[model samples]
Each structure stands twice: as C-alpha cells, then as structure tokens.
Target: MDNIKLFSEPIADATPVIELFDVGMHYDSGEEILSDVNISINKGEFYFLTGASGAGKTTLLKLLYLAHPPSRGHIKLFKHDLHYKDRDAMAKVRRKIGVVFQDYKLIETMSVLDNVALSLRILGRSEKYIEKNVPSLLHWVGLGNHMHNKPATLSGGQKQRVAIARAIVNKPDVLIADEPTGNVDPRMAQRLLHLFKELNKYGTTVIVASHNTELVNTFAFPRLHLEDGKLIKYNAGSIWTLFDKKGDVNV
Candidate 1:
C-alpha cells in the first residue's frame, strides 16, 4: 500500500545503497517474524541494527542479504527492487554486498588464503587479483602470516579476522554483518570496529546487527531497533505507525 517496492534503478551514479518499503516476513506454523519495515540507507552511511535475542535482527539481515524474500513488502538494494529477482540476478547484486555471519562461517577445510580467495573468486575475479589483495587485507586484519594455515588453527579473534577479510575482499557496496564481534575478546572487538570504521570511511555502506548497546551508543550513527517483529527508531518508546492517506502502511 506504500511506495516501498524494492527495485534497483542503477547506481552507476551515486544512489542509495538500501531501501526497504513496507517489508514483512513470516514463517510456517505461523508467527510473523518481521512486519512492515521501511528504511533507507544511503552511501557511506553506517547503521547499527540493535535488538535483544530473537528480536528478528538476524532475520532482517538475512532479508537484506537476499537469503529470503519479504513475505509481503518490498526489499531493494542498490536502488533496485528484489522480491522477484531471479537467482542469477540476485547473485549478481549479491556480489557487491559482503556478509559476516556471527558464527564465523569460515570454511573449515580451506587454508586461510584459499578461504579468503574464495570470496573474490566466486565473483569471477581473477586469481592474480586475489593473490595481491588477500595478503594486504589479511595483513590489515592481522592475519598475514596465517594465510597458509587452516582456519582450525587460529584463535577466536584470528578466525574472525579471516571472516572479516573474506567478507570485505570484494569491497562490496554494502557490508551486512551479524554480531561480528561476538566471538572475540573486547580488545579485538574494538580493533575490528575500527577496521569496519575504516571500511565505511572508504565509502562502503556498513550495517552491523548486534546486541551490543554500549558499542552501538559509542558511535553516533542512526540505529534500527526491533522487538517481537516490530521495528522503530533506535530505543524509541512506541510502536511505529503510519498515518498517511495511503492506508496505514503497516509498520
């Protein structure tokens, strides 16, 4: 009922990186997980997605990453609508978006170099390019010498470093990370936050989903808060409402 259908209009010029209009999601056996969400994130903006456990924070990240279509609303990325986007089309768009999962989803069987290269190679990037980039990136994350080792050999923070490098190698338009620091020590977490800040400084739109309020508040960017599948401006005291003439748009 609102104008939030997600369709990318092309970002060859500067354009909003993400836009959600009247989006919602539900699962079988029947509870609504996310309902009527609307947000617009522009280039170089950093946002934190904050909510307690089971508040649908991760689920919303899944939607942004195109893991699932919204049940009723539109989801757009790079200015394009995405609800009916085909597998290949979606993959193309996804190539420009990086994701860091809370679980540190590094491939256990691969060497660190191989794992990091996998990200770039998946996007059809040349091996020569990956060879040059992975080392510098890993170095930035403090993993330069560990490239030949398997992920199993690294400590929690080291493993996280690998995940971060892999997620960012492509310099995607947007980086969506879920609890990226959950597995690291506080010191390492701070370091990684600075690294992400550096990435955002380089013009990557950054969205971090986490329960770390102290950290969220430490930075001044706007945040999205969710509870029981409903969303509102960060830490606000009321449910979102729509009073426009177009019928309550359901947020």
Candidate 2:
C-alpha cells in the first residue's frame, strides 16, 4: 500500500454535502424506523454511524443514497431539496453517490473484474478505461489474483472487497457503506478504512455504519449514534492526529 495522507486541510468554506431536517421513516405497518432525525455532513467529512442491530443505521443510509424516501420531513443533497418526486433528477443525484451494501450484492455469475467494473460501465466509460483501472483497483484491495473468478467462488471477505471496488471505481462524490468490514479480518478492515480515508482526502464525504465498537474507537472522527430509531449523540472532531500517535497503520 502507498503512504497516502490520512487527512486533508479542512474546507474553510464548508458546504453541506448531506442535510436532513426532521427526517422520519415509517414502514407500511406503521412502524417508525427513524424519527425526527436532523444532521448535516460536510464535504470531506468522515463519520461513523454506530448503533445496535435494528437501530435504523441502514435505514438512515438508505435515505442518503435515495433508496428510501423519507416518510416525513426534508432531505437535501448537494443543496437541493428532496421533497418532490422526480425520477430523472433522483437518478442523476444517485450517480454521484456510491454505496456498499451489507449483503455485498455482487453478481454471482460475473467474474470479479466485471463485477468491480460495473460502476464504470454504467457511467459509459470505455472498455479501455475499465481494463486499465479495474485490475489495479482489485490489486489494491487484495483481489487481483481472483479477478477471473466468480463471486460465488470467493470468500465473504473477498466478496466484500469486490463490492467496495465496484462502489468506488467511479470515484463518487459521496460514499455510504453499511457494515463494510463485517466479514474482513482486523488488518483488512484497517486497510479498507485507509482506502476510505484516502478517498475522503480527495473530497468524498463518507458515512460508514458499523457495529464494530473497537474499530470505531480506533479513530477519533465524529460519530452518529442512534438508539430507538432516533439520533441520540453526535461528536465532531478530528481523529487523524490521535490515530497517527497511536497506530502504526501503513497508509
């Protein structure tokens, strides 16, 4: 791995990358999954969404990625109000966000290279570009040797890496990951975090939902804590200096 800067200079003119105003989500069964949620994440900010199982961490991420519309209240992405229903507009907005789902969601029938290259392909990138970058990205994620294998043939950790590669290949402006390190080993989890941190340095706002408390404590980034379908705690600060002093992480 290369020695990439873990943190970039803070943006003095911080722009809201994601904003939620009294956002709420409820199911058809009248069960509320999220309630009165209000939060704002700025460009280049990295946050960990920590909560217990069924605490609505995934629900919140779904709202940001435009997967689930808020049952009530407002959501603003890149400063645009998200109150109206506009398929074309939503599709355009979604193109700028990358998501790594907990299920990995890899195509079992496709080779690892093709699976990781799907994002670039959907963006109409040329085959030449995919060929040039996908392999290198796979190598970076420790999946280079398995590029020709199908997802079903890979281990849980390998599939997770492939999903990560696919989500980030196009360099989306915002990245949302749900339990991205759940299946990987501790070392690999650190590596994945480093990748996300590197991307953050390049101006990508990242939100990672995880149940790994130990991993969360390793970084000093602000945390979004939810309980009983509501955001109960939020801390804002830099964890870079602390991490530099405490860990010998490469890149």
TM-scores for all predictions: 0.85, 0.86
- Pairs of colliding residues, candidate 2: none
lDDT string for model 2 (82-115, tens) is 7447888888888889899889988888999999
Residue 151's C-alpha lDDT in candidate 2?
92
Q: Return the number of clashes found in candidate 1.
A: 7
Cα distance off (Å), candidate 2, residue 42: 0.3
Model 1 earns a TM-score of 0.85
lDDT of 1: 0.77
- On residues 1-251, what C-alpha lDDT tens digit does candidate 1 reach at each position? 11221123333325677888877788886788887777777887777788899889988999889888888878778878774548878888988899998889888999999998996777688978887777777777778789999988999888887888888877788899999988887788877788788777667888898788777666666667776676656423344343343222221
Q: Candidate 2 regions off by >4 Å? A: 2-13, 236-251
Relative to the true structure, candidate 2 reaches a TM of 0.86
